[model samples]
Every structure is written in C-alpha cells, then in structure tokens.
Target: MSRKTVEFVFASAVTTNGTFTVSYPTGYTKGDFSRGVMHRLIALQSTFESPKGITCSFGASSVTVTYKGTTTIPAGSKGIFGFDIAGPDTFRETDWKKQNHIINRPAILRFVNFGSPSTVSTTALISAATGTEMPATAASITYTYATQGGSSPIDGANTDGKLYPARNIVTTVTHASSVPTMTVTHTFLDVNGNQAVETHTTSGGGTSNTITGSKAAAQLISTKIANASTTQTTTGATLNVGFGSKLGFDIPILDSTQIAMEIHDGAMQGVWRGNEILPFALGANEVGTGGVLRRIPAPINGRIVSAYAAVEVANNANNAGTIAISIEQTNSNGSGVTVAGCELAFAASATIGTVVSGSTAEGAATAEVSTGNQICVVATAGFSTNAQFSGSIVMRPTYTVRGTLAVADITTVPSGTSGDIYGTYTPAFTLDGSKQVGLLVWTPEPNSNGTPQYTV
Candidate 1:
C-alpha cells in the first residue's frame, strides 16, 4: 500500500505575519508512508521553528506523529479540534508569543547529514616468514642447567630455624669432536617449583679452550608460579559498577531489589486479559475538584468515546393501538456538526422485539399498547433552556378506501396540544473525561388524588 501525504496549515490572527506561509506539497498520492512522515515533520518544524524533528509511528489505519518540542500556538489552538488558538497559562514559555513579543523570528535548522544505515566488512589477512636453518646432529641428548650465570632465583632461603635449601645445581655436557663440524647443538633441562622440562641439542666444539657457541635446536620450559587464578574463578559473573554510567549516578542510591516486579518470558501470553482501570489528571481550572488522576476500567471490547440512543414513539388520542417507535443509535466518537458521522435507526416494530404476559407471549394478533407516558427523543442546542429547538411532526398513516378514517388521518397527531403528551427531554452534552457528570430525571408532582397530570 502507498502512503498518504497530508498537508497542514496554521490559521492565527497574527496580523503582522507577512503571509504566514503554509508549506504544503503540490500534491500527494494517498499511501506514501515516508512522504506522510516528512509532511508531519515539516509541519512540526513550521509550528516550532526550533522543532528538532517529529517522530512518527505507523498504526493499522493512521500514522501518529509526536512532536519533540512543545508547540506554542495561539492559546486554544493545540487541541484536536480547536476553534481558537491561545497560549497555555502553565507553560507560558511554550505559549505562542504575542505579536508584540515576537522579538525573534522562528527558524528551522536542517542537518546536512544525519548518518548512514548498517552493513558488513570486506578485508583479508596473510602470514609472513623469513628463513629456516638445519640442525647439526640428528641424535637428541638432554643436559641440565641453572639460570644463566645467576644466583638463586628464590629469595626467601631462610625463614624459620631450619634453612630452606635450594635445589642443587647440575650441568650436563654432550659433544663429540667429530669431523670439523660447522654447527653446534646444545640440550638444556630446567626444573623450577612444581614444573620441570628437558631440552636437547648438538653443537660444534669451537677450537677454543672451553665450550663452543651453539644454537639450541629445541627448548622447553615448565613454569609453576603459585597462582590460584583458575581456582578463584568459580563461576564467571560480571559485576558492572560505574557512577554516571548506563543507569546513571542515582541508581546507586536506589534499591531496585525492594520494588515489586514480574518477569515474562518470550512467549505468546495475553498481556492484559481482564479489565484494567486507569486514572487521568484534571486541570486546575476544571469545573469539578481536581487532584490525583481518576481511572475507569477498560471495557472488554474497548472504550466508548461517544454513544447515543434515541427513541421516538407515535400515538393518538385514543391510545388503544400499537405505537410505532423508531430508534436511532450512534457509537462512541460519533460525529457532530464538526465531524462526519454514521447512524443506524430501526423502525417501530423491530424496536420492541417481543412482549410477555403471565404465561404466553404477544403474537401479531395482539396489538402492542402504548405505555401511559410517551417517549420523545429530540436534540437541543447546548443543553440550555434558551437553546431548545422546535420542529413539526407529521406521521404518514395508510388506510383502506372503505375505512371510516384515512390512514394518514388515523396516524397523524398535530403536536402543541395541552394534556395530550406527558414527557420532557434534555439534549445530549459532553463533559471532560475526568468529570463526574450525571443525568437528572424529573417527574411531575401529583395532586390530592395521588395521580399526576402532565401538560406540554
């Protein structure tokens, strides 16, 4: 699917603003996600010239854009559907500056190069060697030796009463003055602490007084410096400690272990199956009391943003036959004059599915009677007394040619007659999400006979 590119504009009463330009694209094809993101980002930039950028998350239907910085538009302009723009009292710095206070014009800074994406490596390596020399003798002989021309390597020779004697020194010589040999071989054995090793070599006897200089064909050394490094490492556990590191300096002062917690494995487990109640904070200037945020349990299905139910009943003077009723319903977040809407209305017969008597149900043979009072559902402006809207009602009733009264005459009842209907209605209104709103039902008071008579 392609992404949709939506353009944005800010309408304010900034008179001095030289054509408060709205930067929108020439056109956009509906499904471009990238273009959509870019559009929001640019809009955010336009709102807060210092706006770093906008972060966009793609949902099933729409993309959500979160502005990094606070957008200070005219006072009331920050809401989803705001009519006027105004600055917030609390966050004055974030409030849009008045035309007089517009000391500095807002400007957007563009980063030349954000960075690059990810990838792999492509280099290679090889080995190098000089040359190899052959040994003089094929036969291998072992020789013992001490640290070359040095005293005992061990320092603590005497500690207690008895002197700790060092291992006796020993030397072995293996050399045969054969045909004038060009190379010398020497074998050396070394024993130290708990480790020991033996080495062999053949060398030419230099025509000198003592020994000839010869290269040791092979050499081995065993070292056992008393070290318990392996024993110390029972199990490899890493302890990370640094004051202003990953978690910050404050973590050291906090005991995260004391907090209650639950762990989840990587599996297909329902996150929250049942109801989860949450609270929201209310503004200080709110109509009702404000303190901690209040919470409402989440519906099994979902929350109802808006819902409306309307029932209309039609009746006559005799009130002996079935009263036709039509019900109009709307879901949560239903549209008003400001937004689009969808409504469903079921006619009178289907409105009341069934009726029951003492033992049997009412069939088509039995006509549904009207209840004492009629249910009138109507819309009023602003829910105020002065806002009551008036309109005419006309019922289209059908009748046979041989009928005494015409169907339209039988069904239609002109409104505005006193004592004919007994009901009152209030319009639907909206309160803030954190408010405690309620419906007030009023019934007419009765006279001496204890029977109430209501007049329109």
Candidate 2:
C-alpha cells in the first residue's frame, strides 16, 4: 500500500509551560502508525523548535506536546506538525491492513493544558482522493509481572541465610476462536548445569486466556536451587513464546537488576515481560553490637563469578574507632573463604557527626566458591564511644544448562499437524563458568509438509 501524508496546523498562544494535545484526523487510530514511522515523520515535518524544549509523542488519535522550558508562544502563533501514515506491509501488518486500505482517517487537534487559558485553531490536510476500509482480524498475547515473594530486610545483624523468593511471570492470550488452548514453556538452569523444563496448557470457551505461575512450578525452581552442587554456577534463563502453527517470538533475558521486553507485530498485537532483582539491607548501633553480616543464597548450583563489598559509618563526638569489612564465602560444609576486605577509621575529636563510606573490590587472589556455599559480609569495629554502621556484600553466580527446555507451544490444527514451538538451549560456558541462554521461536511451513521451519 502507498503512504499517505497528513498535515495539521494549529494557531495557539501559550502563556505558561505545560502540555498540549493535538488529536489526529477522524477514522485514524493510535496504532495506525508505528513508533519508528512516527518518529521519522516528525523529525522530517515537525516545525516546533527544540530550543523551546518542546517534545511530542503520538498516540491513537492525537499528539501530546510538552514544553520543558519556560518559553511561551505569542497569541495567534502558528505551529505546524505533520506525519505520513502507511499501514504495515504484508510481513509487518499487525492488527490492520495496508495503509491504502484505510478510509476516513481524520486529523483532529485539541488543546489540553491546565495552565493559563489559551485560544487555538486547527486545520487538517489529507492527500488522498478516497479512502478504503479493510477487515481486521488478529490475535494477540501479553505478559506481566504477577507477584514476587522471598525478600529479607538488609539490616546489618541478620545471620540466618534466606533464599531469594520465587518469582512468577504471567501471560494472557486473546484469540478469535473458542476453546483455544495455549501452551507456555519455561526453561531455566541452576547453579549446576542442570536444566529444567515446565509446560502448561489452558483452554475454555472464552475469548481470553490467562496463565498464572503455578505453586508447583515455584517449588520446582526452589528445589533446583537447593539441589545445586558446589560446582554448578549459572545465571539467568532463556524464554520464548509460540502460537500454534502461526508464529512465535524470542524474548531476551540477561543479568540485569530489572529488565522489560515488549514484542509488537504492528501496534495492537504484542507481548510484554520483565523481571526485577529484590534488594536486601541491615542496620546497627554501638561498637559491640554494631558489627553486621549479610549473606546471599545461591539461586542455582553455580560458582561465584565476582564479589564486592560496601560499608557506611556514622560516628558521634568523642568516638575514635576503626571498622573492618570483608566479603567471604563458605564451603558446602560451611568453611569460610575470605574473598575481599577493607578498613575505615574515625579519629577522636576529628569531627562531630562525621559520616564515612568505604568500598573495595575483591583481593587479587580471591577465589570462586561452589554452589550451596554461603557468600557473606563480615564487619568488626573497635570504638571508645558510640558509632552506627551498616554494610552489604553481593556475589554473582554462574551456571550451565544440561539440556534444552521447550517452554511454549501452540497448535493451529486439531491434530496438532500445524503449530508453533518455542524452546531454549544453553551454549558452552566461558572460562568463568558463565553461559548465554538462547531463545528459539519457530513455525513449521505447510507447503514443506511441515518440514521447513520459519523463525521469528
């Protein structure tokens, strides 16, 4: 389909810094233009000055412009912004047909600012002689972070080692057919090279399907961590989603504190998934009880890849003290292995209410600990007066995957003759015992008698 150009002209006066909304022409929806296309068109046709700190974003039927600076346009000033809309092509078509197939696309502009009152006028220019309408039929899937548990406070005095809470990832599927069954697959590795796979299916006579993380699955994950040997050392997992015989997409997962992934076909058809790292803390006062230690349990059977320590101290008047901090790990039998250490000193009469922080990397001779080993932070203080302090140690573990896990599947045909399948495979580990998780999503081609696979 050919691209259509639409222009919008607004004559408005702004007396204050705020946001303004300009609605698109009638018949055109937000998803009609992809983010990339909108950005390109805006960069080409936008007359709004960036020096004014003006930034704009496109929505279903309108554009919201925000002025970050204190600049104001004189009354009756004209602001022109325009963009070209061409619906997704054959391969890119998400929820709608080609751009040429859409008719009655309207350009409507409206002023939306609670700031000073302003008057504005708008006009739309469409380059099409006639518009065409096309039928829309597309299925979609979405994912969200459901809930997470198993978190411990980071206060400095907790000695009991606690396992990280089990996490849940949820997804929803919407289809046009009744009694649609969707299959989801999960593949993850423990600190050991052991890979586990879980699959679940749900179907009913409804338009929407929701799959929640099962308690059994959570238990399985926890069990894997507990069973990890001292030698196992892997981090993260590989994830993929499939739609029976239709298509599938691979989602990315990595060693980040928090990550979010979104899959979009056009605008309306897509999925979103994300994960977050829980935080830990501890606090204490007085030199005697002021020493604090924190431990991070191994998620899977994996060796420590790296370790670091951070400590903060607050001292009162007449307090002369020295604080020592170290990162240590234990063997399976609970023997201690010191990985790194640092020391902080406060002088008497140096200053009242002085705060100090010390951070250090692991010693050069630091060694990696095995799975089931406890990695900890230990602190000691010698003081003549009162002092308060707290600290935490973080250790990253690495592991390998023994085998592949098929996480998701969809069957377009009743006999399951035509469908999509998604799986994850672990590659070889690096010298540090770390491996990359692979996501695979593919569908069998019908003409090839289901022999040829098409990857997405």
Work out the TM-score per prediction.
Answer: 0.13, 0.24
Q: After superposition, how far is residue 77 of candidate 2 from its true place, in Å?
A: 86
Candidate lDDT values, in order = 0.20, 0.32
Query: Candidate 2 on 1-456: residue-level lDDT in tens?
Result: 223344444446554456666666555566554211222123222443321234456676786766544456544444554433432323333427554445433222221111211111010000111111101122212221111112211111111111112122233434344423434444322112233344445454465554543211112221111112233211111112211111112321111111121112112111232211213333444354544345555444433333222233444455565544333444333325555433455575544345444443543445354554555544444443344444333344333323222332221111212212222222122211121122222211111111112211
Number of the top candidate by TM-score? Answer: 2
RMSD of 1: 38.8
**Cα deviation of 332, candidate 2, in Å:** 8.3
Q: Indicate the worst ten consecutive residues by lDDT in candidate 1.
A: 121-130
Model 2 gets an lDDT of: 0.32
